[model samples]
Target: MFTRILPAFAAGLLAASPVAADTDIAFALDWRFEGPSAPYFLAIDNGHFEAEGLSVEITAGQGSLDAIPKVASGAFPLGFADINSLVRFLDQNPGAPVTAVMMVYDSPPFSIVGRVSQGISGIGDLEGSVLGAPPPDGAWAQFPILAEVNGIDVSTITIEPVGFPTREPMLAEGNVDAVTGFNFSSYLSLARLGVPEEDITTILFADHGVELYGNAIIVNTDFAAENPEIVTGFLTAVARGWSDAIADPLAAAAAVIERNPAGDQELEGRRLELAIEANVLTDYVRENGMGQIDADRMDRAIEQLRLTYEFTSEPDAALYFTDAYLPDAELRMIAPE
Candidate 1:
């Protein structure tokens, strides 16, 4: 399911070099500080970013799609966002200076999180149920494709457009039967809301027929074109941080707590572990390493998107992502323990 692709026009991919001076990098997170975001904090706490001669300030975002416009408008030089949303954004906006530079979630966390007590456990269970979905949720954006692939009739499902803050609470309060969200985020939220573990059911899109990549480290094409070394160095430090995080996710969560004092350390730690086990440390990542993606898989993802989206022009792989700024393969690999 993976094919190593060497892009002929990748400018900085061949050079394993360092940046000259400290560059101020403003990184925009796709969501609020949580378990999965620990690696970036670990990168900062462990001096990985500093070692790369970068002063990075991380900003929290509203949703997966929130970071797209921030990076495209040059508000943030780098960001974490859903590449599928980026595909749609590019189609609608035409010439946005943003593209995924590194693949973070090799397997997307998109899922329909439901409570078993609410008559939901599998994809088919969603029928005749009210599903709460945030309008901008990345998973909701892909619901059409999920439905098509699974043979679920979306018309039979009642979709209640909910806010991000209310998506889980609505389901937890029995306002809706299920919710579209990231598996880890919604599952943990329901648990925190006093929903029993046995009562929760997370039907991941990947487990079904969806072949989609998840959130990725996106960059402003303008910034990357001007400072390729800075981009490469930043990605190298990110790889180091993720490798360390995979080794000790509890430590990674502790790093996150250091930034957000209000965060529950135990909960975040569990969330981080879940993300590492379920999304980040997939067979592809374990065998091939991080950052770089499978070319064939990406093509399939594009085709999958084509099912729900109408591209303004021919979808060019180069315009969406590149391994140009990724670190060396060895540094990117997260060894299994």
Candidate 2:
């Protein structure tokens, strides 16, 4: 029972006299267009953004950290960012103001994969072993806290910045004992390369002390404040898009392929399959509905950031998001109708 709404501007124009015109929004992605970002592609391909009265111009971001400053300065009104980096930004730049409109992945998928034959049971055994990780500028900053929670000394582990495509081969060839990568893609790629599942050990961040949320839809605080209605409309449409994606993942993947013709169909399929398995909404927003944020989880994440990173001060929860924009009907979508 999917119902489509007309573009927000059209609905508004029809309801009222000819006044000021439509509003435009620019959305920045944390990486080049790919599968994990299918919902956004679906929204665009299916006219969801247009229906919400938004003319969205999507752009690829340098990375999560790079996206934040651009968003804060209004280089882009809205952007996708890693939740951990968002927390750090809030702590450092209190007045800059940003809010997460919706969460993309409820669980962090970053994991350390090691060969089982190496006797790496978990994070504890990684000590004294060479570990390949992305640069500290990326998600590597959180690895220390992950190690701490696992009773491993942060200093005892050597973190070499192994470039993205080289991580798998480096580990396989014994250049590094283990490597950090997305469990979803890396595991499947390893399997495709003939690495047996039984021979691999994965230490997921969610299973450790890194309990922060992952990819999130965020906007500049001023933009959210100045154009609350636009924000609400965008969020409402995004909610519908996520629901549509979850209800029919295969359709969603096809929609993604249609939008990004250059994308790899096999990789996108695998990515979507993994996303479904992760059940991104469970244990967090499932009860409240898609795109809902839990204040408690946010609070815990803030505390963890403070304790682990020695953040100078705590950030106020209200600054990060508002529930006012979420449509009531969309919030009920996760329930049995």
Candidate 3:
């Protein structure tokens, strides 16, 4: 049966050759392997990365902001990071030489979840409200910039760091008017705890002019240039893995479970569901195919980062990303109807 052969086949492929030893690559994760990392697990489980002669060792990163320095210092050849963190890193490091290979979420998942009873419909309504935010260095630091673009005064908002444990309780117990978090992650958590859909209001940052990418595969520019074939092969395998994950998210989730047995099952399940919905619904994949990046969008993202964050100088396009290795044909492969 296919099921019986699949696991063995995957194992064989990973062990088949020492090519990975010769051209080994380390992929640093932005966080612990949970929902957002299912595709990488799927690729490894299905022998996709192995087929490309890539021995990818995936390690958990401290966080997005911290992950940048490690990648820039060549601690890892590849890393998964958000566009905001990447931009900030480039601002500080100047010529660090890193580039995005592909985008994961077409729309950044950052959002403010408000209790509907408070009548917080948009960013404009948040003025004078108690907003439970992550720390200054946390993901929520960008919310002020998002508010600024939408013509909302950032000073009118009161921000208090909710730390990590108090997000759901703060929102449910009326301790905070709104909380900053990833819609896919936090919304699902709330819904699972019986938060009514009508009571939940999500305002995505991308809708308000903070348009930026999220969870992209990044590489060292020098490594990509010197080992073009290796880069091409790795991307091709990743594309195949992405298509496979899209075709069967259940299988992808299972792959993730196989690797991280201690991970939250319900959270991983919800993550896969949301990822599939976001991936299929976006114009990023529908028009240009999966893993496609638009130059205009990239420019817009860069501009937003520069203007909003006040970069000392323009980041070199070459240092941020390259599409030379993106497999055009492979990216277009869709599941059979």
Candidate 4:
């Protein structure tokens, strides 16, 4: 009932679409198995990929930038990663074979998680406080733009280059006043570390003035060119998987736990819910279906990136994302929260 549009409009057309011979796909993820990944696991379990004539193996990654080179190198045919990072990678590499086929998170999860008790109730409050940032972190990489747009004085802030493993724990222990991370990731991780939920202040970059996007599904250009039908089918299945997750996030989280047994189910479920409500299902995506980017917004994002990263070449939005493989609107629609 939460799904606003009836999907029957394109069902017949999608059924008539040419089916690719069963293909095996190796998918590289941006981070370790977590709540956000449940949709892909659900895709495998719910027969979405099988229905698309594809068998997929999703590999965990080290960080947001981890999948870019792997997918670009053709070590993996497809990957999920940050588009901002991808822009930088492509600008630097100049003829990389990888490009984003689908936009997964309409609004990015990049955020600054701080303790309210540490006087980090808002963006300006970040001044004169310790900010723990991981060098390779996608969120931390974009902190400068978030700072520039929000008018925060970076000089007053003490930045600590922390490791990913110690990021949230250091904040929970009050070792650092705040930490840069994904909204769903750091917020829930701190709660699990026994930090009071009310004391945690999540400053999502999207909610602020930052006009950037989040992670997306990317594919090797050569692979997509050689197997166009397979690429389309894979993207369709991925969209279906996300729709299924939006329908029942708790069940989706359990699907993730099936593969990552060491993970805490309840905490992951909460994390999944956080991701769904905050990042995945944005107002723009609610009306426009998933997996497609807004050109004007993407242009704004590129301009914002210029504030922090110096592009080696002029940025091209076409080189970054192509919606050629996205499923029809009906098929891409997810249930609104």
Best by TM-score: 1
Candidate 1's residue-wise lDDT over 1-337, tens digit each?
A: 1112123312222222346656667788988889898898888889999998987778888898999997787766788999999988988888888999999899999999999999998888988999999999999999899999888888899989999998889989999999999988999999999999999999999999899999999998887877788898889889888888888888789888887888998999899988888889888898878888889999999999998788889998888999988878887888565
Relative to the true structure, candidate 4 reaches a TM of: 0.93
Q: Could you give candidate 4's per-residue lDDT for residues 29-75 as a string of tens digits?
A: 88888999999888999999999898788888889999999878777
For all predicted structures, in order, the TM-scores are 0.93, 0.84, 0.84, 0.93
State which candidate has the highest lDDT. Answer: 4
Off by over 4 Å in 4: 1-21
Q: Is candidate 1 or candidate 2 better by TM-score?
A: 1
Candidate 1, TM-score vs. the true structure?
A: 0.93
lDDT of each: 0.86, 0.68, 0.68, 0.87
Model 2 lowest lDDT segment of ten: 11-20
Candidate 2 Cα outliers beyond 4 Å, as residue runs:
1-22, 117-121, 136-138, 192-194, 259-262, 329-337
Looking at candidate 3, what is the lDDT of residue 160? 75
TM-score of candidate 3 against the unseen true structure: 0.84
RMSD of each: 6.4, 5.9, 6.1, 7.3
Model 3, runs deviating above 4 Å: 1-23, 136-141, 264-266, 279-281, 332-337
